[model samples]
Target: MSSLPPVTWLQAFEAAARTLSFTRAGEELAVSQSAISQRIRLLEDRLGQALFIRHPRSLSLTEAGQAWLPSIQEAFERLAQGTAEVFGPEPDAPVLIRATPAVQQYWLAPRLCALHRAHPELALRVVTGVWTQDFVGEDVDIEIRYGQGEWPEMVRESLGEERMTPLCTPAMAERLTTPAELAGTTLLHAAGFAVGWPAWLAAAGVEEIERDTHRLWCDTQVMTLRLAAHGCGVALAHRRLMGSAETLVAPFDIECHTAEGFWLTRPARRSLREPARRVWEWLADQTGEQWP
Candidate 1:
């Protein structure tokens, strides 16, 4: 393991050393003066060196402290530069948007091409998965989620209702002639939507359908669609996500209601930055007719 002091400690020490006052350092770092002293003490113990010579009325740097100050300040400067480059507002750079695999592949990818064509200066980086909420903690500016628009401490805007239907490959479609045939076929399910299969079956006028009968279960909509396209089994999928080749045939005429819908979420405090707002508007425009 690395023996270096924690980055937090190093930062605190550098700030305190530069200003030569714990109170001033705390003011710069937005912490209490006592917290600054504590951090410096921790850093000194970890490094096994004294960084400051405490006096009655003033603080002075020891020889070791003076030698370390320049390096520490430079290190922090580099870190700040790197962080700004990665997350800073650069209008020409690609904006990072987080979503699940299904939405990225089916909904966003196609529309993004149009966005790029219109604003070639703007690029897109799509991050996918259930853990994507962590992206907000990173450089990501916006996130598209399939939920009920109830995310805490975030600005949630309803994108639209993603209506789902029973879809299958051409081969699976040939085998399933009626809604009753679904019981015998391999029913593929996605983990994200808890009520996909049940809600779809209810809409199809079928009751008592066996949930345990599902042969394939995937966490991502992309995986479910891939399995469905490859004739793994009949899958209940979002109609908007289905491509011409993927949706070779419709298994059932009846469409179902999903408990979850697409929503645009961002940090409640941060103003919708330009790139993020542009993408949001584009998505809203694309789904305007279908959203209710």
Candidate 2:
């Protein structure tokens, strides 16, 4: 285990280094000025490095302090990003549909307009992310999860089989005619997808191509699909997600099926509320797919 200074000490040092004033750092952090000084002292003692140069009336960052500030600031940024991804946005309805960010932004968000038009009396909320929500106790009534149709204690219904195909804008589609031709152009992949470029290429019987040729990888389907729609490159995306975007086009007829799928699920013990059941049935109708 590494023996770095505590987070509070690091925070105190970062704030003091930025402002060059302990009093100002304490004011910003809502703490006593003496407390800030004490923390900094403890940190410097631990590291055995003089971070700040103390003068009679003025203060300035030493060589060591200037170098450490950027790393500390970057750590805080990553922490905030992780927090947002885990907790996600707040729900505004008693009946909430929880799913991944890609589905929420591209597929479900557009369908919500039709849902409202069909039944304005029903109010609904959606929570989006790549992480799974706590359906056992949370207020989420319906969850569209991406995986095998098994959730231990939850009731699972088949939304659809997950199919992946290469998609691009109409302008970009004009240049491609066959699966082999794709190697000449930029290939995009969603890093989080169950099936990616490797599986799609293998299914298409494409072999012995350069892997480094202008390729882009995205962490989410929303970004990957949007990049394809904007003509950035050809992205491999789910059939349903690709259908949602009007600007995207599937130039080839080849597609690959993955092991995972979108499953409409809820706790077996807690049946969906009345309003949630209405939306759930409407989703089944909108997709023209059967559900159990």
Candidate 3:
């Protein structure tokens, strides 16, 4: 009676096209692989055009399928949006954003309050990981990663330049008046960074120190900064990740202006929902404000 195929066929086509694997689409849609394949076969037959070029172990969209996918995706997005507008937003619907543990604990943790105050209507859920930028999962909408901004398969937007400096408690700052005085206090080391006590000491014009200058090693910069804040030792950390050192002080004017950077990124080729787009822009605008 109607002039079109069933919505299920279109859904099957969309899912299969997105995942490029019938088994994965079936997993996402909670159906069998055979069922997904059958629906797509029916869809192609109904439209009188081949939708996929199926190989022994994989699938790729044909020209027709590629052109028609955007309409289906948009239709589904609008339907969900309209349903929410007519009724109410889902209780658990929040924009999922991911950042590394150090960024979450230091940089982003301090500014979340301002973001929430500005957009109380938007719900944000934050998750942390130490993986590289290209490793974000499929469901995450936005990500803030720390590196040289060179990850593949994603576009990175800069958050301005950040530099590394020595951070210590107020008392330690008093004791560390000169580069030569570093021998009196413990030296905190955050492993895996190119710049450390050696480079910083060199910048401060001190070649070497005594072997007994107390030292502490840590796997993460967040932990190193926390230890410094608690009067354990002095930590050399980035300007952006200076939250844990709120009560701490920079003992010297010396800083390491390395090639390292922080970036805001999202998966390539994915269209952002309205809420996710707002948060992304907000994060970019945060660079202009005073950061702790």
Candidate 4:
């Protein structure tokens, strides 16, 4: 063939050949029967071959139409497949979690296995830092902060209250049974934490002990807990931060109510994305605690 027929003419020919009726093809293509007949005639004139046999009562495909039918159907099928592959069923977006090191290490890290099992399609990104992050310029979708749940412009929910108590290795706890015993023994301290040896000692009714001397100090609860679990000293620890770590024990029954607590916060202006919502709900389920 010198030149191929136009696409509309080919489509009309294909439809008319498949149905063997110009009226049925017209109904399928949302065109009039005369329009289908005219286009098929034009296609035949272009190809110099009769594509359909016309009968007064019915219609049938010509030899040439029968030959071309398979190719046209296969072409349409390939286009549909390619289109679906290019634009269908997008992958899930990654949920970003920003948290303090203690929460990231103790609480969130341990519960991630359950989250992954629950939401297998969700991708997770965890970023840890010292302070509560502002979401205005950050990519965080969820944030866990250790403080009073009072972020002014953010949507804040309390995970739980952070009650501090003295924790040590099981061996150390075996020797010291009373709150008074914590004063004379080695006391571990987390640097810059509001709930420290001083506050805990006061709560335990042992305020006369030296606050400055014979203490092990670290920058984070992660480090402090590790040191205390390894028989360094009794460290002031948040209850949730223990997270089924069986190596540590609370020696004294007295607990101090700290001004700080763990909070789950997000930006108030924007709604959470799908992945973020899954992670948020997963965190709530894992903790079995939530605040209004």
> Which candidate number has the best lDDT?
3
**Candidate 2 lDDT over residue span 128-203, tens digit each:** 6575543434556778788887688777777777788889999888988878888767888777566788888888
lDDT per residue for candidate 3 within 151-248, as digits (tens), equals 77666787777788889889889987887888867888987676677877777777577364788899788888889889998888887565556787
Q: Can you tell me which runs of candidate 3 are displaced by over 4 Å?
A: 1-92, 131-134, 210-212
Clash count, one per candidate: 0, 0, 0, 0
Higher-lDDT candidate of 1 and 3: 3
Question: 271, model 1: CA deviation in Å?
Answer: 1.4
* Tens-digit lDDT string for candidate 1 (165-199): 87788777787888877886788888757567877
C-alpha lDDT (0 to 100) for residue 135 of candidate 1: 43
Task: Give stretches of model 2 more than 4 Å off.
Answer: 1-93, 132-137, 210-212, 287-292
State every prediction's TM-score relative to the real structure.
0.67, 0.62, 0.65, 0.63
Per-residue alpha-carbon lDDT of candidate 4 for residues 1-292, written as tens digits (9 for 90 to 100): 8766687887887788788889999999999999999998888888788888888899888888899989988887776555433332223547778887777767777678777887777888887767433333455677887777777867787776668877888898898877666556777778767677788778777777755447877878788888887888878888755545468988777888888887777766667777777778778665555221
Off by over 4 Å in 1: 1-93, 131-136, 209-214, 243-247, 289-292
Order of models, best TM-score first: 1, 3, 4, 2
